[model samples]
Target chain A: MKVNAKKVLMLTKISKSYQNNLVINNFSLDFNYGDSVGIIGKNGSGKSTILKISCGLLKPDSGNVLLMGKSFDSTEDGLLIKSRMGVVLHEDMLYPQLTVFENLNFYSKILGIKNVNTKIEELSTLLNLSDYLKISVSKLSNGNKKRVSFAKSLLNDPDILFADEPESNLDDNGKEIVSKIFNDRRKRGLTNFFSTHSEIFLEKCSNQLINLKDFENA
Target chain B: MLNWFKVLSILIKKDIKIEFQTKETLVTLCLFGLLIITVFSLSTENNSLINQNFGAGILWSSVIFAGSIAMVKFFYHEEQNKTLQSLLVMPVPSELILFSKSIVFFIFLSISEIIIFLISSVLFNLNIFSLKLILGCIVFNIGYSVVGSFFGVISSKSSSKEILLTMLLIPIITPILMFIIATTNDVIRSELNSNFQTWLGLGISFDIIFLTLMSYLFGKILED
Candidate 1:
């Protein structure tokens, strides 16, 4: 395969399986900066698996994943690449015992974001999380928890964000805020890679779409 | 380098903070440890010889059992909450995650040890406060925390995690368990100078080797 140094993310012939069942078979994709890519598929169709593999959360049995011209093969390079990326998976991935502000603060510290308070405040406002900042995550509704998770992914103003079902558990207003966030990220030339069942959400946030149903038949 | 330390400290702080808020691990460890000590003490009542010979065994066994139970509770929350997954996607090195957890577990184990020892001293009339015993515990705790934290994450992936953690942890830590028991026996019997250096050296060696080996393996186990 010819290498593209400028591609923001590249997955070459990626294959993954579980217990002799192949979920993603020799799938390949190239994502560039500022491109909002949406992956749609039925349940068990490997939408989340591909996002997990691309973010280095899960490893593929075969093929290579490159982010910003760097691969996950090298530990140092993997850490560097991950530092520039953000991910929101099916789980909220927040400490339920901690308040929303504390959860965001903890993540911001790990991401090495300076001016932590200001950035958290800004995101909280954008996500309508200002009132719920001091509330424990466990006390929040699913929509609020998703908002907090969304805020966390943007804590570092990451170069790329990978989210699975970004609209799950979100209300109409919460979905609109998420749409706006993606739009703003796109305007700033940041990439978004997400999986969703919502056709309207996919259309609003994604300029490029990959239907895994096609890959399954092939 | 500085950023690495900053991140490590942050992770450690987070674990400690949550632990304090819930007191889940510490309380469970202390209660379970004390129960073991109480049973052993009651069974060996008025038998000084049995107490002299078996006090260390009772103490260290309690430590092992309690530590394992506490580790299960500790990592269960990390798995249930998917916080460990969150950390994996960040710039933090996987080894650092292991190291930070080991440190936090070390702290919790140490605190529980202090309490168990004090209670054991009273119930079993054993001299657990000696310099030699304390040093031995320091070595053993370091080894336990490193090995336990490593296996804790592995077992956390399973459905029968509580049993899996203990099954994986006990066999691996048998050598350290023997070392501490032997040294604690020497300390309790006032035979402090009897091959003390040799056993201490062995304990320290086990700690360093496992800490290095487990740190390397932890990163690999966490992948995919």
Candidate 2:
């Protein structure tokens, strides 16, 4: 028996306010499968909240979030939807106590991906993290840590990837490697919603960039 | 319910690997442990009844505080270095992250408590290696870490987080520690038989209650 599940994330009039501080004011967005979009917004515009809410991190006071045609319910049934999506927020979400290999091993265990070695090897080579696998993530540079975070986002081979500044603060070579990894991911039918402050990258890889600069292009 | 053990194991293995490297936390923990032991030794004379009564209490208090000194830095280390994003991105429940952190802290507490047990016994010239007391301490330490971890996560974003963690944590943990002290007395002085088990039960219940609640609330705090 074959199971077919449609992947569409819909936010209908999502409004969130934290103690008289309004973050998101009646924002609505839709992401059907095969859509790679970037929301270009300054800090504290609720871009991260939007992604986290969809990922079940925050429950909007008044809104309806639907994942894959299912209500974004807090019930146990929604675990499947959450498991299929990957997210990297602006917050440092990686545990520093874990080494590069241990961190990758953790995702392998979390995702229940059998035979994790091949991808681990591939990601290490592609990201040039091979020498640093045994080193703690805390011992690495910010750029290298970001690379590990990138590799972790792909651990589950997630259908949807919500990345907040995925490739932030990297040199030219790092940017190229990040772009390459993203381009490879794009070919795999990976649905991604990205937010970044790097304008050069925004101009480079944003297939569907939404911003105040060019509504016409959007 | 999720597979919390997977969270627990991954956290332990990963933390142990890192902990072995610099031994930063363990070293500071031992220094703090030694300081507290020395304070107890200087404050009162050996063979004093007060020393015997306060021995287990001081042992655990020092161990818990010392363990928290480093373990409380667990999430903050991740926060500062920006590696926490990788863990948070996994498609697992956010509470698992907090749970895993707490369990690692609990393991550190247990290890420190073992060290305290050895050192205090030597310092006070008394043997505290009884099976019941050790078991009680284990349960008590686990409960303390579960509750302590929530505060640890809460303080990660605060301005004076260490003070905040201690302020909120100590009051809540006082009763748990009381139970532990009472149980230790029961085991050492041989006053009551299975009555000490009540504290163990209470400790386990506290562990379950706080672990579950914190596991749920971690997502909220972790959110922007």
Candidate 3:
């Protein structure tokens, strides 16, 4: 006997462009539970844009994004789907003037997570950021800030995690931690989608590979 | 609804905490306000009637300009680190984000206004110690902060944020400015005239309308 995975996210007939050039044209993909995908492309490719549009950050010129069988049509719809998804874009998205503790604590409160301190401590320890919790984000190194950003995204234990260039500005140990986190989430029947240029990182984290060049150039 | 208030409180608290640490907006607002009050006091020192008649105008004009500076600075951190994107991705509604920013900016503006009020009262011998004046100031701040925060987010995304904020802010807020100036004149004169109630009513109405309108518009503008 074999178990069947349900479709968790679907992007259909998606097309996006900037100025006059087409970035993503008629692009579509269906992701099932426990599926991990890595989008690969050149710098000007629409990999990040695709991730953004799928997560409701950037709207596609013409397409529909369906999450758990619901369409992104209204504010309420977007909010409902977004709450179940976590995103880490290229930017750290942490307040520079605030400490790591403060940043994570604030997000936890907004996420309505109970026992926030315990959650912060657990994630910080896993990311090797236990000692930097009290330091301001501005004073942290790029790798440390990246780790903090990663920790912030996992605070809610999202079912779907979308990361744009997840391995950027990270040391080998940091990358290993991120890869391990991805594997852990996948083992728990969650889904992960990320865009990266590193083949090795993609192999370690993603089970499905999407070369965005094939979509954009075709 | 309960969750909305909780998220609103968290957003406001986060902004206040960051501001307390950096003090960038506070310093700019206070220093700019002080400079305006100083310039006006010196310019009107020799003229008794002008000082008495136009002192309220001078004080409010200073606040309007200085408060805009603070509003722009308030959104600077969010743009710098892309924290606005973080907030938008949360479970919270976009309208609540605008409301929180407006509330935080209002508190900051009110604090600076108190300092401006004290300094102007001493320098220009202004008798601006009336209950109606206090209430009017609250109404004026509400209108300014709501509209200013809305435009501030837009301008902060532009290449020329400071100029863009002023250009978008001043014209839209003209009616509110007139209402405040009229109410301030009555306070400065220490006499409630026939038009005092009318101006105060206008100011309150402006606050209500813009606050509601801006809160709705903020969600739409931010989503785009």
Candidate 4:
């Protein structure tokens, strides 16, 4: 593989801690377009924290996070960069009171994706959620809810996807579907950065891997 | 630049749709409002000390207390599933998210107030149809929703959410409550006096000032 792609994400000397317990220490990495980086770590090792910081959900104690050469300092720059990204955190992030279809539809409209129904229908079909489109998110099982979350992140055909434990509640078939989606997106030069503990899942979906323990050397 | 009005409209629509589907905020607010009125009516029955003069105080206390509950319930949905975090990462500006929340809660609070007014009117034998009263309600609702939504986000992040919300909310809304009570007193007495005008002016001022300030601070608050 010719590693000449444009750098899509960069984290330089990032440091973060909670309650005086340092989680990520001087972490640094750069990801180019089409690079599928999987972050692996033990519990409380800051895999999710790094993802959150990179996606601008959590501000790092000190460091710079550049997405496509722009930081999240200015609202206009932040909005422009985030418009091309998607994220799935530990929580499902879908409204429990809303039906599966309504949740997707809401996000699609927010992202300004036209033909909302068609976009939602396509994602529902891809995620095997067509039958549950009318069902409230609170009524769905954990695995089903995970599928809905994944479907939401993919609704806009995001240029970058940041997911934490994307395979947490997924079954084998669900895992395959997610892996296929990731692989397809990668082939189209979309960047994927995710945190997970499943080696098998990472192997199927990612081409590069980083262990958070290495960052603790500081 | 794509106009953000359409985005705001869709955001409001989604919130309204979810609210109508669950009826959590509306039902809780209205039910709590009615219960407060019943308790007040019972406590003051046959008590000459509690005449029309105190009726405004009683009515607004119920409105503020019950409105606080509805405000907390309004944000609960966003916190439970981390939907606020989802919205934070979206392309839209952060202040717009807060604005949408305030708008939705404003609508719910208005509906809740109508029910509260009807119940209070029947129980306390007070009038409820004055244009001044309606104007006062609108002003009060805007002030309540903007300040409530701002503090509601902070409180929802705490372990003691309801207590924190009340502690933070009650003090900030004290001025608005005072003005509302004064206006309501005139409404209950069916007298459009200078006092009503002064209070309404104060309430409207508070609304405009707080709405702008909260909207400005909202984005900074979410950046953390």
Writing each residue's lDDT as its tens digit, candidate 1 over B1-224 gives 12778989999999998887889999999999999999888899848899898888888889899999999998999999999999999899999999999999999999999999998888887766888888998999999999999999989979999999999999988888888989888988888368878888889999999999998888888895
Q: In candidate 3 chain A, what residue range of length 10 has the lowest lDDT sum? A: A1-10
True contacts kept of each: 0.81, 0.45, 0.70, 0.86
Interface RMSD of each: 1.6, 4.1, 1.8, 1.4
Please state the CAPRI-style docking class of candidate 4: medium
Per-candidate interface DockQ score? 0.73, 0.40, 0.66, 0.73
Which window of ten consecutive residues has the lowest lDDT sum in model 1 chain A? A1-10
In angstroms, the error of model 3 at A109 is 0.6
lDDT of 2 by residue, A28-100 (tens): 6776676677878767766677777776667787788877666646544465665677776655456666678
- lDDT per residue as tens, model 2, B36-107: 987988786786587778877777678767766775566566657555555544545667667676667777
Which ranges of candidate 1 are over 4 A from the true structure?
Answer: A1-4
Per-candidate TM equals 0.98, 0.84, 0.96, 0.95
Q: What is the alpha-carbon lDDT of model 1 when measured against the actual structure?
A: 0.90
Q: Provide the TM-score, chain A, model 2.
A: 0.88
| Candidate 3, A1-218: lDDT as tens digits | 01233688889999998889988898999988888999999998889999988887777889888876666677776777767778899999999999999999988888888899999999999999999999999999999999999999999898889999999999999999999999999999888999999999999999999987677556
Docking class of 3: medium
TM-score of the A chain in model 4: 0.96
Clashing residue pair totals per candidate (backbone < 3 A): 0, 8, 0, 0
Location of the lowest summed lDDT over 10 successive residues in candidate 1 chain B: B1-10
Residue by residue across A40-84, what tens digits does model 4's lDDT show? 999999999999999999999898998888889988889887788
lDDT of 3 by residue, B56-175 (tens): 788988898898888888888788889988878787788888889889999999999889999988999878877887887888888888999899888889888988999999998888
Cα lDDT computed for each candidate against the true fold: 0.90, 0.71, 0.87, 0.87
